[model samples]
Target: MEGVIDGDTRALLSEDGALDWCVTEFVRVVDARLPPRVFLRHCPELATAGSAGPITPSATPVTLQLLGSDPRGLAANAEQAISQGVTRLDLNFGCPAKTVNRHDGGASLLRTPERVYTVVGAVAEVSQRHGVSVNAKLRLGFDDKQLALACAQAAEAGGAEELVVHARTRREGYRPPAHWEWIARIRAGVRVPVVANGDIWSLEDYWKARTLSGCRDVMLGRGMLADPWLARRIRHWLETGGERLSPTPWSARSDMLIRYADAKRDAGMAEKVIVSLLKQWLNIMRGRDSEAAARFTALRRETALAPFVAGLSDLGSSSDSTSSGTAAHASSTLAG
Candidate 1:
């Protein structure tokens, strides 16, 4: 994803010239006592993205993200990460993956405000000591809004410089009516910068959220994935109030697929891994083209990236990309 986002994907996305900050994949905080080099490996972009060659400017200058549950462990990891030139430390308390939640990372922390307090406090202390900044990403709550305000309060009390709150409770998943109203309440309750997240899949949603939350800073995760230009559009709307965002051209998308496949190959991923990655993106792309949707279904039945790319090339060549796809089309399959 680094090479794709920083290479050809960025190239195609920036053609219209818009987009701001980006965050890398979650660098799992696996061991409490791992070496700094391991952290560096996960955050190699601390140097720059697409360094292999033909460096395209990263879609948004990316911030290295870290995920874990242990306060002391996360603190130690943050210390090493900052020492290695990481500019910002984003604690992931909003990931809804079952594996992560099972381990008490991500959204599970919403079940326990005390734990959130401890973890945020530890990371913020380390960040302050090292002259770095710490931020928290969180969901409403595991079951309801009972713990939502408490979690924000804990994060703020623990020294978080900002909070990114996904509107829905962990149980709510994603449905219509994103509950941006809740984000507004969280903004009112928290003194630090509160970013409105969740359900922001269109320019209208972004504007409505900004108006509702009264917070200028917003986080676009799935929204950006579904439409890479979403952030730039949001930035444009924030500045000029109405930016037209067209979908990626089929020809451009085809070129992007080839480049992504090549980057995956260069990165040494297996053919299956490469295909799987492409499939992930196509889950959203499919909504724009019935042929693409059918091809993705067919590609899933195959075992090689070559066939997948060939299929996409064929489909892309035959169809025209439109701007009327679903708002969630870009991120339909890729979860974060």
Candidate 2:
């Protein structure tokens, strides 16, 4: 979610009232302490009076996420984020990127529960001093699934207000069939609330995951990427105990894409970057829509920003016919 779940994506997801809160892309913590501008740069929501970002027609609160190995450096950075009006902070211990693991950050920490405890403890101390909530997101383990309980206990011992477990080891690396049973084990072991994550792409998946993991709360990542209204649908189901709503039409999604583009433009991103991001989203959508595949194939080669935008505009006009069909297809596939 590093490059994918940027400010624009958060704003786009917020449009449907699906997200209760969002965590920003991890701010890398190195040898030196980063300035407040660094946090704001990653999460522009800090500049908003309510510490929320413009999510189309609404605003959603955002939590700042930080990644690092050093206990003190992360703690110091947490202090900086809070000073800038960040109310919630999340520690990243679940990232599986090779580059991040090589640097002794992210899921690599799973091998050393002592270090995890130290890091989380330091940040929690700082957060407590300022009355801010500190949470941790972690995978089951590094390469050993058995170590998951120890890691969860470490996080709880270190004072993590809540723990989010992405039910796979670092070695699994987004493979199908996330091990949600581990989340149930972690929940039983930890005193803090446990939120389950991974491979929840549809309402059926959500129900299965909730039952398997024994978790009422979930954190949607890729599922939200594929379906923006996922959270709204889940919320509705929880409230009314009725059948899940049908997926939003692809035509409606085109409007969201346009809004996302406008958000990036408003944030001063270059047109090329915006185009690249759009293609990235479309590629993810291609998993569910043949029309998206065709559209991405056509627009992937366009280099100029204006032409790319115009092409999207043209595609948006004709998306209605395929919208419902595409949504049904995605839902059936995911549910299956």
Candidate 3:
């Protein structure tokens, strides 16, 4: 999601006005504070932010996410982001990438909940002065669920106003059966509100996740990518007493992809790079839509932007998407 869910993607998805907020991809922090450009690059919305800080064109709040192990450095960068008009912050300890872990970031910190406390405490200290709340995203654990509750409590104790639990251990990767029940355990154990995340791909999944975890809210990830209207769909169901919107047609999805390409082209992105970006989004959509699956199969190996964009106009499906290729950043899946 670090590469996949940048500012443009956030705008497109949040434009429906169904989502409460969106998160920028994690800003990788090491020992030293980063410059304002780093934060802006990850969240271009900041450049045009209103008094409430950076938000999507539809006004959904965008939370700036930081992935790192250094507390003092994270604190300094948190202050830097605050200066740049970021009103919200989230610490990511759920990413399962080996390189991130080996570098002493992400889920690797879950192995010792104490470290979670220290890191979050440092950032919270900075954010509190600005009257901004800090939140944390977490996985079950590095290797198992033993430390899940401990980590949740650690984050809350360190002043996280909310906790988002992506219900799998680092070892589970993105495998299915996301263990929503485990989130229930963590929710019961923490004082701060816990938002259920991971594998809520449809209305049924959302209900199951909320019912199991007893959480009032959820964080959507790949599922939202797979179905751009998912948030709206869920919102409709909730508002209309179980009324179901018609399933997304492939044509709609295609139109969205084409519009994304048009935006990139307007910004002078390379045609070849746009081709790859289209493929990455299609790759995610194929997982949950049968029509998307067929189109992905047809266009899987296509390299030309023209052919790829043309292929999205299939007769069967309808909708709207983009990506950047930084492999480590690419694998940085948050929430789900």
Candidate 4:
């Protein structure tokens, strides 16, 4: 969500009461020396700009997530992040980027439980020393589930406060059916709180995943990207029954795009940056209907933001009456 869910985008979501907790994109830990501003910039959720108020309230407690293979470097960076007011620490073992895996940063660590233990141990030591919670998000395995239980158990032994298990192997991209049942096995195997991830896109999906995983907490990814109101809907359905939150109106969508544009403008982003962000947003908005899909496809072809958002505004206004603003069913069609 780096290029997409930055301060401006998150601020837009927050205005709509969509997102709760937001994590910064992984600041790859390459060495021990990390600048203080880097933490503030990347974890902007902890800064005033990320907060609800103009400069007083923080955006959200942005967890500084780091990805690397070295325990010493991870621990050192974790220390610096804590000193910079990072509320939480997340170790990434699920990213499937080619460069990341080539450098053994993301899913590569899943291949070695010993390494996961060592890295988790170092970070956990720093987390406990600083009184900050440390968590890990992992794929089931690089190639199989046999190592998943071992990898999960090792993280627990190494002092991870919580674990979010994505129920698919690394080979599986955002394809079809996710292996939700595997979360059940991992939960039974670990002592720490286990958050079920992968394939949860709607309220029914939430209940089904909970039943399959035997767990309550879940971490949504692509589903949330597709339907920004997913978590809010899940929260609403859990508190009530059959009551669905409506989508943000067309006027609100127009306002959101304008506000996001202004935030990006203040951030000193290039024109291309604004275009890219709006294009990604259109892709997410495409989850609505065929008209939105065509509009997003058209928007992606352009090299501007103003026109793209305007087109989206038009499409949103037309679809508000016919389209389900939030998810109508619980499914993981956006799963990857």
Candidate 5:
């Protein structure tokens, strides 16, 4: 979600005011405190003065996330983030990227619950003094489920106010069947609230994840990218007693893509770079929307920003930017 979920994406998804909060991509901390520019780059919202900390335009809170292995370095950086008005912080211990693991950050530390305590304790100590809350994002364990409970308890003992568990182990990567039942185990074993994450792509997935994990809230990552309206969809269903909204029309999706392109261009980003970003987002969307898939196929070879956006905006390419009876699959295609 690092490259995928940026400030613009957070703004668009949160604008509907359905999501409780949004989190920035992880700020990779190492053995020393990073500069303010680095923190601001990862979370531009921090520079905005409105609430206790960074919040989206709609006032949805934005929690700054940090990822690192060293306690002292992480704590110093945590202090820097607090100085920048970040009231809520999330420690990322669940990233399964090979590069992250090779560097001894993220889920690599899950092998030792003690290490989890040491790092979390360091940041928590800094946050508590500023009246800030610290949260932990975790996978079940490094290579297995053996230490899931120990890790959860260690985080709580180290002062994490809440834990969001991406049910699979580090070994599982982004594979399917997220073993949500494992989250149930972790939830029952921890004192703090546990948030279920991974594989929650639709309203049905949301209900199933909640039912299986007994968590009151769940986190959205790629799911939000695939279907920008996922949070709103779930909220609508819950508020209406199982009533389902019509599938998000293709025009809505295209409008978002075009708006994203315009935003990057306005920021002075190169045409090539903006095109690449749009392609990345469209690729994720293709998995859930047929119109997006067709547009991606037609525009993938394109290099210019204007033409690529035109391809996304064009609704006459046989697919016609219409659901055409694929709405059911887009909304609830996966089977348990």
Candidate 6:
């Protein structure tokens, strides 16, 4: 979720109650300890109550995520972030990016469970003094799934309050059919809560994952991006046993994009960057919605935020134009 789940995206998702909590994109730890400003840069929510921000219609607390191999440096930075009012810290051991692994960060640490233990232990020990919670997010293993049990044990022994298992090895690289049974095995081996993650794109997928992983908690990443109402739908289904629901219509989805753009603009992101982010979101949505694909095809080249907003406005207005009367009314109701 590095280049993807920024503050704006988090706000958009949180506004609709899509997440109970969010971890900011990884703040890299090198030889030197990072400053408080670096944490603020990644998660501006640290400036708010309970390290929370107004997620539009609602608010959700965000935890600071750190990625690195150096236990001391990570501990120091985690301490600084905690001192700056970050109430929770999540260590990133699941990122599969080649650049990050090459630099001895991310999933490469999985090759050595002791390093994971040391790093998590160091950070947890520091945060525990301040009554802050520490957690770890991990893949099954580096290239082999057999190491997952030991990895979970390491994280627990190192004082992680909870563990999130992404149920895929680094080599798997987001392939179809995430192995959630591996998460079940890890959950059985560890005493801490194991939150299941990976390949959950719908309510059905959520139920399937919960059954396979034997986990009550689940985390959504790309799935949430593909369908903004996914979490809300899942919550409703869990409460009401409803039938599968369709995605939000084009007009309503367009309003979310507009709101995201306005939030970014208000935060002082340049027009070009805001436009690029909008296009990125649209591209992701295009895979699931034909209208989004059509709109992205029409405005992918736009370099200014004004034109992008105008294009979205046109897309929203015309969404019902090509539909039957009944469909047009449904779209109008959704927009309203």
Model 6 per-residue lDDT tens digits across residues 221-311? 8777777777777765565546444556787668788988888889788999888878887887888788888899999888988978988
Per-candidate clashes come to 2, 0, 13, 5, 0, 0
- The true-structure Cα RMSD of candidate 4 reads 4.2
**1 against 3, candidate with superior TM-score:** 3
Return the TM-score for each candidate structure: 0.83, 0.90, 0.93, 0.87, 0.94, 0.89
| lDDT scores in order | 0.68, 0.78, 0.84, 0.71, 0.85, 0.79
Best by TM-score: 5
Q: Which residues of candidate 6, in runs, are more than 4 Å off?
A: 50-57, 243-246, 315-336
TM-score order, best first, reads 5, 3, 2, 6, 4, 1
Tens-digit lDDT string for candidate 1 (208-260): 87788776766765555456657555555445534455655565555666777
The local lDDT score (0 to 100) that residue 60 gets in candidate 2 is 59
Off by over 4 Å in 5: 317-336
lDDT of 4 by residue, 1-336 (tens): 446755555555544344445556788897675888777776565554322312212233445678998999999998988776775788989887778899888898999999999999999999898788898888889877789999999889999998878888887854557788988898998889888888776667788888999876777775665565676677666555667766544444445666777788777888787878776765665675455467677677777766765676674345554324442223221111
Q: For model 5, what is the alpha-carbon lDDT of residue 21?
A: 82
lDDT rank order: 5, 3, 6, 2, 4, 1
Per-residue accuracy of model 3 over 1-336 as CA lDDT, tens digit each? 645687778878777678888888888899898988999999899999878989888787889999999999999999999999999999999999999999999999999999999999999999999998899999999889999999999999999999989989999988988999999999888889889899878878888988998888888998888887778777777776677777776766777788888888888989988888888988899989887888889988988888788888655433322221111101112231
In lDDT terms, how accurate is model 1? 0.68
Clashes of 4: 5
Question: Could you give the C-alpha RMSD of every candidate to the true structure, in order shown?
Answer: 5.1, 4.5, 5.8, 4.2, 4.1, 5.5
- Give, for candidate 5, the lowest lDDT window spanning 10 residues: 327-336
For model 2, how does the per-residue alpha-carbon lDDT over 215-248 read when each residue is reduced to its tens digit? 9788888777677767777777676656567656
Give the TM-score comparing model 5 with the true structure, all chains together: 0.94
**Number of colliding residue pairs in model 2:** 0
